[model samples]
Target chain A: MPAVVVGPGVASGASPVVSVRQVGFGYDGRPVLKRVSFDVGAGDFVGVVGPNGSGKSTLIDLIDGILQPQQGEVLIAGRATREYRRRDLAREVALVPQSFALDFDLSVREVVEMGAYCRARSGEVRGDAEWTLARLGIAELIERRFTELSGGERQLVVLAQALMQRAGLLLLDEPASALDVSHQLRLFDLLRDLNADGLTVICILHDLNLALHYFSKLLVLSDGELAAFGPPEEVLTPETVEAVYGVRAYMHRHAGRTYLTYSPRLRGERKGRIHVVCGGGTGAGLMRELVDAGWEVSAGVLNALDTDEEAGRELGLRMVVEAPFSPVGDETHTENVALMRTADLVILTDVPVSLGNARNVEAVCTAAREGVRVWAAEGVLAADLAGATGALVESGVELHADTAAMLAALTARDGSQRPA
Target chain B: MIRLGRTSVWPGIVLTAGVFVVCLLMSLAFGPASLPLARIWHLVTAGPVAGDLDSAIFWQIRLPRALLACLVGAELAVAGVIMQDLFLNPLTDPYVTGVSSGAALGATLGIVLHVAQFPWMTVLALAGGFATLGIVWMAARRRGRVNIFILLLAGVTVSYLASAVVTFLMIKAGDDMHAIVYWLMGSFSGRGWTEVELALLAVPLMLIPLFRTREMDILLQGEKRALELGVEVERTKRLLLVTAGVLTAIAVSVSGIIGFVGLVVPHIVRLLVGPGHRGLLPVSLLFGAAMLNVADLMSRTLLMPNEIPVGVVTTFVGAPLFVYLLRRGKA
Candidate 1:
């Protein structure tokens, strides 16, 4: 979709466009990036994501040759970055900064032409500027004043300015952070088209979802260290997200695409532990809500690949997991019972009644008989075995219609027990 | 020539050059002893005869003053553009860096020391201006890179300190008060070919910004963005600050602290041709010369023998025009 082919000559096909080797940078003795090493290969689209103050912006500056690493080196095209002159490095790498505010009245055409400041003045400079603007689908903005454009339009114009440099490697620092959703998509799409034409891009962004959706590779930074690097799916695992961001994340596949949704790990004062007897996909939501509500939740008798088992694992909960689609064997049943015996209360979700998971109900009844409070929803599982259900009823087990009603009952019971 | 909107910057530059030519001729021809246009043309054609009074006034008096005005005007305007862009503040002027105030202090000292003669005052002012620049430079340097924000604050602080000393000297000197006051008021009245030659020294420095027009334009977005875009920002900034400081020193040394032209000419040229430095720098240079020439002409002619200060005429003409431009909403 680009109007012109703007890229470096493919001569350095053997070396990565960027190489940061054991680079460590600091400001005033405060480290910003510590022993970070990564190589961005030719024609790669890389997205850099990190929490605030994780050296994402500093990393870009180092790679752009604006900041030198105190300990290690950055090599562009297998040459030491410090060796290249500023103009020569610019010809090899272009950066579209996060934001620019021009106070003077300057036309977009004039602003874009400034991108060729280091290049010798030729007639092709104007043609190149026009083509770059056209490639970004903003040819009409050439005559508009840069100060008068919307934030989205201004970012696109600035991107056009960087493209006018015709460099192979392009770095953007949160270029889409100020844009609306539609504009963000439009900007990424333009970046994609440009990348398809062999423009190597490394963008630093805060939106992890957008990073996963667009970039081929993701470099995650945490506390001034490279936390993970590789393909998005391989690198942005739930465990990595929790470790780096102190939050629980659920990876979901919907409509043939993978994405993640996050929940904050609100670690408040210690609440009493509760054991959940759930199977299939029914208890994932309940487990998350209970964890968020300051309860230490444990789940049991779940098959290894079950949705609830994955959710519990992602939440870092202690769970008794069994093999997939297998009957609750004696070992896991005893483990589930021991888990319930340690919990202050046991809650059973309305999972489908099946012979394979029939022992989960019996495990709850056994815990109740042994002097632990047991709670269950009146569902197919409770009704399947009348003898077990009758024994549970006789042992003072509380039954609610659904999760909300059951949660309300639990909240009321806690409030009565511990009044403020 | 660059195009902004539907119009090309060529027309603006051409028109300003045309106006500068007219201002040049008028400033040379019309004064207290006004020469007829035909007679002025004949004198120019005759070319600097040694013994005639009218010819002496035309060649020896009016011509050099006009040339000095044009040179100093161009220097200030170029310095203004550099300072405004370098600081990324529209309120920035050539004197904002404290160089002019330093020059004024040196000129005041020259008056007080009874060395208020032609070259002594000029030399002392240049020394004072450069010394102030060195002081501000050291204050802003951090790890070999200049911080413009810190530089601005330091310049302002130094400017106030120098101004306080100038005020004290003005209050102390009884006999030399009028001489110091007249020099401070800024007139091109008795500046002959010597001052004109001294002002001409800054002409090459003025052209330095023209070559870096593109870099100056890119710097409008700020230094970080300029660096990312591949500009040698620290080097460019060092060169530009020194250029602006030197130009300001020379201009202020020749003409004592002429205001408004340095502050307002760049803005007007920017409003006319947009802020592309390819257009902004050259157009502002020509327009600044023209505006100051006309202001100097009006100062000599408006009240005739009693002549108003050229700075007052420039402020009187410039202040209203600047406000009008601001109200037009494009600035």
Candidate 2:
């Protein structure tokens, strides 16, 4: 993996565009944001992500000067935002709100022209309005009613309006929330292009993958406080994600980009340790089920590049591996038996018998003989397990049709170990 | 290459101005004693067509009353546009601040108590209008921002309260109900040079909102968006509400509660030229003036000598058009 540099800000050389100092704010005496502070440099493209009611939108509002912080200060361009006149601050910062419902109809050109209001001496700013509409590539929509445009088109026009203000910092509140996939990409591309032109952008994003893919820096807000703020690769670890969002996450790298997969965390602690013995992709599903169900899981005596091994490593499970196309060596078999010896239960997944690996069924039978509880998948007994499957069941191994039945049997036996 | 034509606003302006002038001329000529267009022109230019009746009716009565209607219509329409933009609600009108109801209450009290005459009654009505607005303003304002929902609710509450008071006074007046009803229904029946002058005085107040046209446009996007765009949202809203209240109060004092012009005229003009107030304001001024002047003419001629109050005629014409607009789902 390429090294991701972690720092105070992305554009470290450039002066900060927005500097929030221990800002605390709330509505109707109930605090929504508490002592949140972060610095956004002049050319930074930062994405703010959090679960619902996490103050992502409140942070944007404070930075945009729509709401004053009850405690601390927000400074734009080295001046306190509260001290700057509204028009002066407007020339420094512009916000493209999520969506606006216009009560009266205004043409796209007219709407965009409003961005130049603070600069214009009168209502007319013909040159600036025309230039902005053309620049945003929506010159064709200049005469169309704003209410009649598609969601993406309307968002683009609103972005055009904000750009026309010529503000140094642009704040967007979930700009892509209502857009289709294609429109979402189009909006991000537009923002990227604008950022390339030296505009600093801070956007609140609900989609974590988009934030990881697009932003140089991520600000993770959880329940109105800053959980983490750093480079995406540094801040978006599985542990941090699970801690802040309460979901189990797995980060994967493909095509030189990182993707995060998430699932609801099981709401309890581990009941006992379990060893899963299988190969040829049969063990992958059982390993995931065991891990999510709060069992300390280990899987092994398999070829190095097996799909199960990959899943084990992704879910951070302990495993023993041997080289592919080779027989299970004595060293690997010994390691698998030692793992089974410590486990409270051993599970054998249905795997077809092969010359390279028939010892997996033997390992389960050996563990059952040693008084370790052994559970065999229903189909394993019918499979041609080199004649070891019959011995495995004859050794007093339990049989389960599926993962659900296995989990139910384990839960019943480990009732005393279950979390309250 | 796509060519940009000059705005398309000028053509609408020209068309509105033409309609206004034609309506004014027709209103001046048609009345209880209908005069020929040529004769009316002569009366204005050549002074009375061999009779004092034509001269008296032309200069002193019809012309002032017609001009007063034009001015009141323009003021009310401009006020409506400002209120609609400030609230960002199409249903909002000039009287949303309870100005008309307050004026009605004052006019009713004056009739029942006999405490004031025409000019004094106008003063009392203006006082009542501002006082009621002040209460609604206080009730709705919080942390220096006017909560639009609260403002609307307070306006409705105060309007109901004022109407209840007016109803109580109307019951006390008993036999004087006809006189109070005529005033309440709103009319330009006896308006003269003074009423026209009063409306002219209020006409300049339209410039307050006109100067803030850009702010109003930004406000139409929604208050929070406007504030983010660097507009002093609270200040702009307060200025617009006060200006609209003052204009509506003045119009109501002179012509009673002339309904619909303040509510419907701006909407019609908006449909015609779009909602950019730079164009909408001026065009609405013309269209509003024309509509009221024509309605006043209808009031005099449709029932002849019986003189249906101009307010009744405006409602008769405006309500159907408003309903049509509602059915069309365009307003």
Candidate 3:
């Protein structure tokens, strides 16, 4: 199915199979893989992470000898990698790469079988295969066509093939990227088992939480350079997270364990707002401010149940309520007039004062004439109400634009906190 | 990750042997000889003893031609397999990089000017191929290292130039057109001990060194993975390329640019056996030999009075099979 399937079972109890020393590689004279060097112990499981385009994949290729370093040499089992015979190298080292489609339609099993091609005639190919698939939890997927499988299933199958080689050293490129949460954790668990069983593994990851949880060694890559390399706790500091993510953050200790969280600053400047004569239902917004500013509020000249009337009810404001369903009918006008006379301030809403409600408008004028303060909406409706009432020419009655100005007028001293 | 599965390595082995026997019988029956089957068998068995014209014709003429077919087929097919894996391209063969064209131009130069007496025609052809590959490689390289796309481009450009040069040389050779064209077309006609002896001398020598690389599994998958496990990537690649190129050059130098066997034979055998360099290399070699042998037999018999070139016979037969394979989703 693969143009040819070589079946060589991975050698057992082999010595360290690969090594790199002071390696520096670049492209077009710009360094993509710098003079970064590290050793993968016989069964080492190293996890790599970085920002986008941070050269993690390239490091894997370089470590495996796909690309040679300009400045350093690569060795396997104490011998120069260049010197290990081909069959010998294959027997000792195996790679399980990220899954890719071929120009040909080989089955999952067929594709996996190609890994054994070098050791085609050697014994235990089936056993190795069964073990590998079982370890990856994809034993039943062997018969499924590779193209038809889900991304997670395909990843496991590919990993199974790489593991079937039973090589001492495995180079994996994001082996669990497409898997679900449990599957990703399971994949790491299997990788841990393989490492424990003495197969050196190198994997790349992006999630700091998972990387911290699963891997013992964390190689932090930034801009194709090694930012830090050590244990997760040693390398993953609050300062490091801030440096990489380019934000202000803190390492918080909760319940005796440390975690990273951010204190977000304003993203952009605030746009200011002011409200005009918002009586009746209009001044619900003003009630919101009184609540936000920790202030008390009261409004009058409503028959009952106006828009501002309901807001005042919700806010538990002290309100002068008129009679229901009727405006300036006898007793309600007397009550409103008495209330306006006692109030220190009166605001004219856009409510029209016809013959039936002429007395209500007179209360506002009377209040203004008595030097009680008054404010009006800036538009024609509020102007008409103010003119009908004969409030000040410009002295006693003030006109404001939108809600922000109206609220500011109510709570002018309180301006420190607002959304950006 | 390509997993190695249980393979029917024996089927390919059996089929290869079967093809050899059937081809030998087919060959004895062909070539204007009106002998009975029993008589043909008797005639072949009755000799190891030679001297008479009939025996000489059978042993020296036909026997060597058949053997040459086998060797050339093996050489080209194996060479194709190696080249394909090296390039990571299914469509590529040994001559995808114009190794054959370069060899053809060199051979044409050799025959036209009678330079065969000096540096040796096979040697000249090999040099021409390696030199052109070098030039193309250098041209493909820009600033420093060679990329895969650049190499492929260089191969296509060099192939075109080499074809043009060969055509010019053929025109300049004048009245010697018959010999030149026939040879260019390619055939095992009139080939006897010298051709077999020459192929035996060159092609097998290259295969011996290549066979030592039993770890070709590592080489074929990818060089880096192999190196991480302790394979010297550059050295292995160099050795493989040189060995494969030399075998291909020898086959071309002797057989006169047999096309597609290197491409088609490997693909067919790979579909049958798999990509293990061990099985792939050997199966491709044997299967290619059988394919060419059959094609050679057809060339001689199909147009008996006007012999067809073995190259023509092969392309004619191989191209359709190749198409069929692609359609079958086995390409």
Candidate 4:
């Protein structure tokens, strides 16, 4: 029988549910996890996130008593895992594996009932398999053959099996890796409900955004060591993400939930500066491309709440922002011109011309006349250019159909100017 | 919550038991000297009448042979289920690891060297079986893990080597070639009470695996998952392999390599009742017993005074049925 708890809330100073004290593990003399230590309190939904082969799965195995650490011990419920009997540990920790294929044609109920093997007597599964399957919203799959279910359905059934064990602590290894978006949300919702009912869940999530959305705490592993462990808001900061994953990430909050978006950093030395004259969501992709190619990027005359402004701010690019729904003011235009004057190249994006920001086209023409190399992106002139297209074309502005063509032109120009 | 009633396996069990009795009766009644069913039934209920040919044949020859067939069939089929479940491969059998070829080589050596006596042959066969299994294991181990594909390849290689040696020994036994060749073909002819007793020894040994059905069920989900579920995977594997090896050794000693009964009966039972060992094991035992008894009867009566080898009959019946099952399962 499972030990009954008071409720979902963990009292202050409650004993730790899981404790890893200086544990180290290796395979065939090569280390996979090194001296990892952390504590998980009761009723905590903790997510373990790391790059592939960074020892996240190995840490789960250690806590579940599947793999013993070579250097230090792992304690569950204040006792060493090695000190517990196999069935006793199983009753306390239940693991829903990533995926498992069955050779035999066993019914889903038969597979779920196997979880009760530790508690039941010989040839008997103590728990009601149907009840558990129903609780997971898979009662219809009870009599279905396990091998015939879809991947997402199989994962849900596996979760049902784990629940049948009635374990207080649940360990899931990439439970949402094979699920569709809707199914992933369903599974996380189920997990949250279970956690609300007093289950301590430690899930290894490969999707960082999903982890941020569902977990209260995050344990970040990098190169076999613990990089950070705290509330998701604290542990998933820009610096820690870059250090651990070698990528730049932005954490956004909407409706009181955190979301993470990341972009790969450029390699090698910095390229020359480029000013992008774009707005209304057209210049966001161009700005990211410039940043990734090692160029110092600046965008301007964007309305305050434009998507391009948000992308610029997220990527930390220099920008001249105007008030939303207003014409471009002289102050913003002057700021944009000053930014363009220092640039080695200026880019005109395909954003539609409107009365609110038609001065952006004039700014680009002035920059081109002043000897700044201007590259007019293909779709910009095709859209509404506010009758400034012909003058800009005659002003010695280069034309390119896409970002790839413009990048090639820039690289060729850079190569030609190296001697100077 | 929907309360889907649990499907009981009792009805299937009772139905198979009824079929088993019919097969038993059929095996008792048909032979070269065809006995009447009424007279055979009377002989079964009453003691053998003196100086009666029907009673004499039923008690001494037909009855013992059928009983031996049933016992050996149960042993081999249960061994197949254990081996298949252990490896998690559907095509595996009691002899997949070269145990039968090893037994054949041992029996041939016993015959060529004039040590073909009762207990010596059995002991030699067992020694040979374990030795072949050891060689296969050693050949398949890599970096401290047993790769099952390598093990299958090694088993095939060792089987060929053992069969070659057995053929060479038979060639050397020119005068005793008929005895060695007939034994290699595998027959239940002239088998009597002693062979039945020898086969009965495997029943308790067979129970060891039956008692481990729960662990075997977990093991069917791969070894790593079984470990996480708190099964002592290594220990369970070792115990099941040793028991299966011994069971195969015993069956080979008495029956001289009955081919395809072990391989086919379990698959047939699995198709009939689903593959939970709680149902699969008992059904395989009964179905294996009935199938082999029916095969032996056909082997004796099909040619009428010729008596083909029971192994040959089983191969002819089992191979085609296995193919049908494979295609049907795929479809």
Candidate 5:
């Protein structure tokens, strides 16, 4: 089929250069994205937002030519993403993925120059990296090692690298997840300026305020499906945000802008004995294993029924689940941990440490020293447990990768115990 | 920590010059022929002294072996540096890509079939290395790109299969076991100038192109990122891999299977210096040349007249360092 160009979200009469028609994506026959279709127009800045794992990264990969859609095609400038040469597509579209591996000491300028890659001919450099750096206002950071840059600065450098190609389409996956307020504003301004200059931008953002104030269009994804599409106010309503993110949110107006505070569907208030440092799919298998093994597994702070918590629910385990995804609250951490002490064995599942739940690793370490079986997972990146598990490891507790191994020792067959 | 200022290439050059002199002196002083320095000098300064058997042995046998060590060592280290760069992995040396394995499998074919007794060793090694590399490259490639995540896994598979073919040949050759395994493990003893001259022909041809492009620095950005930057990512990576394979195949053809010089030397140099292959390559070349000569010296002296395979001696030293580096912050 010829690419369907929609003019609805496009500026007045400007038609979409790239459009999707009833595209569905799944992995290993399990559907994550279903019958999804959206249009990206000329100079349009579309903000695709959803909770984590809502097919945001997957969609970007598909658009970037790293992955092929099993059902429908991703069109660029009315042509299939693959029909054009990989370089040709690169010249037209640029991707700024969130993953950062600054292993080699490539300077910021060198990274930005990498943006002009597809357009660069052998024995010749376009020298467009300078202009790109100048545009991002990171011209001063050009010669500095990329790893030495701050989190906010690194984000800008990556943006410069992505935009230096002068690609018409820019696909950013969660551009401001770890930025401070000032940096987030600066990043948004950069995106807005680029959009105003006739560059089509698609930014994946989690903040509703930024999307409402900055982006001209919004695309909300839920469980890998398109939950809502249109202007920020229309799509940022309590119902849409709640349905997309699975929580109860109140849309309140402040300084002529609508801000949302989402609260999850509350279960009955309870005080129980079970301290758990649980998050991510890292704990999914172990949570089921423990629950099925007949332990009272009450999770300390799970945002909601994540893939892991979903497994917990299937096994009929009573977890002190956090409702932050559905409800915005400061008391969720306190409330969840109140029930943490009731558990006899404090199991520390191997979850990656980030600013999001860095304290969870700490909680396990503290509980383990108080005579809890604090077996750490091997094969976990030290950076993931940078702050929390270090002290526990020093205190004679070993860091292991397999929870099954840890569980086996905790529930040993017969009687051969090591010096714990 | 007195910061060793920046690693000066001048220091490397001077150190390399010093290492060359020491190797020359050691080459002259010891070996099968007990040479006196005065007589060696007299043989060089004066045209063929009356009793210059020691000098002839030194000039004909030791000099070539030492030079061959320089060439093979430099070639293997540079090949390793390039392989690590292409993979964007510091731990992935040349063997991980199955380049050396391919060459060994190739050379072993000729040796087992008695074809290697003639001049078919290079042909077989080149054909085997290139062919296995081709099979590996094809199998590992997905969507016109070398997916190293799977490429490493595929290389392991290729190495396994090729080594099995080699093991099969070793079993069949039975009586030639000493010759087959010794050459396969690699050795540089008793080599002459002709072999050294033959090896010099291949090393410079392969390394010059790599030095010119200086692609390792750019390649570390990533294949997709590098491609986007106007680097013909697929072609450049393939060329780099092929050059490295050819260099390694040449080294294997000369030295047999001198293991870990390609793996540990580049990594050791990188730890001392940094990951910039431009400087790292030259530095590793010197360090590797020095290391192999020293190891060869130890092997010859440790068991007088009955030398161990220089390859086994290196692994004995390298495996410990490999484990040490793995623990020390991936340093």
Candidate 6:
């Protein structure tokens, strides 16, 4: 058969390059992919991500036509994948599997040449074996044995073979799993270059950061079902991640790029609630430790755009904020007092006191006087607080030298509150 | 003329073909009653004149025996290549997969039944071989997938069972025991035009895999990977398995259970050329023919009147060479 010269999605005319319609596949009656439906347009770079056993690899297999769906169908180039001959479908889609049984001693050139097995000699639209290897920057490996190369090099050679097919659509199942950081970056960079040249790529990635950073779109799967699918920023939201992965995660935008940070939810281990009065990034580390140690923490009276406020917001803490560079207003002070009133303990970070933020120290002292446990990091605030520090000592607020001493003092206090 | 470079296999193919031609001529000339090279060439050109002693010796006996050995050797070696690649195990050979043992059982049965005639023994051997292949195939199949490890295990298990049955038949054949023992030892001695004709069927079977060289090369990665690379893995596997089975059955019927040649020729050829089936398959085929005929030539002429079984000759020559190549390969 003559080679089908489809440019990316041209084989389907106006349709998508890949249309997976309600596909369900199972092995030995155990379902792996269930009713999964999606479409990849021409030149789309998509990353498939999910927890282990979430049908990520199985979806790649279905898309590349290695395994047919037991229910519904996968259509490549608008034709049902099973209807096309193996060679013809190969001309349309090429897959780089994670690994293969490679015990045979074959030269790199021979293995790469096998990619052109389906096409006629004259129709080798992708260039020769050496040319393809040269394109991958591994042309010197042409005469080397495949089994003699390193894991990353073998993967690159296999990728070169897949490219030699000149398929419009490429599917990779964790192609970066065995690669080092540098090679992983190189592999994805090459994939992006090929995608820019009108090749549609759908890769199954284990690293969510890489997925968000490299791919134009993300397909999130959970428990053999589609969790979400859209642009990476929209599809991989904190709510979706927490719901699907059962972990608390938040996104922060820095330099126009979003990064996701995750913290495990200690279910049923809710330690007592504590309100931390902090600023200038001092509370960031303490807040993270408290949260990880099962303390339900809230922060208060931080100025807008303060470092601690950013950390608090990134950690998804309930925080009371004042205007930037402005004094803590009476309303915000009242909110901070209300938060401290319900707390089992109140933590005060060592921020240099001034008229603008003096209310935070006052609120901590008031909470301490009202039978709430209060711990403060000792600072020059001992001198700067002046009469306020004296009042704090009189109110029975325990001041520790640093966070370690404070945490130790808190652990020693345990369930009992000492008398003032 | 063999080019040891990475590019073309034409020179390797030409070299092996030349070796085959030399071995075939040498095999025809140096048997029990030796014929001069010039006289042998005249007799071959004269083409089987009647009532001529040298012509009868050349055409009726030596020519057919040599051709039968060459064909059977080529058949077994090609079968070995297919089976080894299909099973994806370097240790696999045609006999280890139970096909040859099953054929041996059928031949043993034919010898015991006093129907050791031309076609009956060959037919029954073929039927037995296919039956074992079907049984092993079923044993390895689960839900529709053929598990290769299980297939190899089943092949070895079935091989043992058939060998056990052949042993029992040998113990039971009191008067016909000598003929059974001689057949079990595997020889191309006294085999003539009829056996050559039967062995000629393997030529087409051997040629079938040449068209599938690309698929076979892809399969070196494995079946699942081959499928992803656009090879119809199951269909190709079925066709190659059947070809190997038929070749083993026909060869076993004509020349009995010859060992070593099938197992070692592929490894030798692979060392000479690379493992690309384009070079590996044809080179192994031609080299197998050359190797076996030389082995046969040595077997018939070694002790003058008393001939050792050709199987012993191959084992003696092949075993040391295989170990040396293996150690050298490790280095």
Q: Tens digits of per-residue lDDT for model 4 on A67-178?
A: 8899999999999999988788888899999878787778898899888876676446544888888888888998888989998899999888788778889999999998
- Minimal lDDT window, size 10, model 4 chain A: A1-10
List chain B TM-scores, each candidate.
0.97, 0.93, 0.85, 0.90, 0.86, 0.96
Two-chain DockQ for each candidate model: 0.59, 0.71, 0.27, 0.55, 0.15, 0.58
Candidate 3 segments whose C-alpha is farther than 4 A from its true place = A1-28, A32-46, A58-126, A141-154, A157-171, A180-182, A195-202, A224-239, A247-420, B1-6, B48-53, B114-127, B130-153, B202-220
Superior candidate under lDDT, 3 versus 5: 5
- CA-based DockQ, model 4: 0.55
Candidate 4: stretches off by over 4 Å: A1-11, A122-127, A267-269, A279-282, A292-294, A301-307, A320-338, A349-370, A377-396, A399-420, B1-6, B41-55, B134-154, B325-331
Chain A TM-score relative to the true structure, per candidate? 0.80, 0.88, 0.57, 0.86, 0.61, 0.88
lDDT of 4 at A32: 95
**Per-residue lDDT over A120-181 for candidate 3, one digit per residue giving the tens place of the 0 to 100 score:** 55444666666567777787877666667887777777676666555677778877777799
Residues B33-148, candidate 3: write the lDDT tens digits.
Answer: 64457866776789855566666667777788988998888888877877787677888888877777788778778878777543476667777777777776677665554454
- How far residue B239's Cα lies from its native spot in candidate 1, in Å, is 2.0
- What proportion of true contacts does candidate 2 retain? 0.81
Categorize the docking of model 1. Answer: medium
The weakest ten consecutive residues by lDDT in model 2 chain B span B1-10
Interface RMSD of 2: 1.1
Tens-digit lDDT string for candidate 4 (B28-134): 98887777789887898887788988889999999999998999888899999988887777778898888888888888888888898777776787678878888
**Higher-scoring candidate on lDDT, 1 or 3:** 1
Q: Model 5: per-residue lDDT, tens digit, A204-322?
A: 88898788889888888888788777877877777676566765566656788777764444222222223446567877677655544445566656667566666555544566565
Best by TM-score: 2
lDDT of 6 by residue, B49-74 (tens): 99999999999989998898899889
Write the number of the candidate with greater lDDT, choosing between 2 and 3. Answer: 2
Tens digit of per-residue lDDT, candidate 1, span B1-331? 2333334567778888999999999998888788889999899899988899999999888999899989989999999999999998889999998999999999999999989898999999999999999999999999989999999999999999999998899899998889888888898988999999988889999999988987888888888878877788999999999999999999999989898888899888777787788789999999899999999999989997888899999999999999887777542
Q: What overall lDDT goes with each candidate model?
A: 0.86, 0.84, 0.66, 0.84, 0.70, 0.85
Better of 4 and 6 by DockQ: 6
lDDT of 2 by residue, B172-278 (tens): 88887888889988899888888888788887797888788778778887888888888998888888888888999999988898888988998877767777877
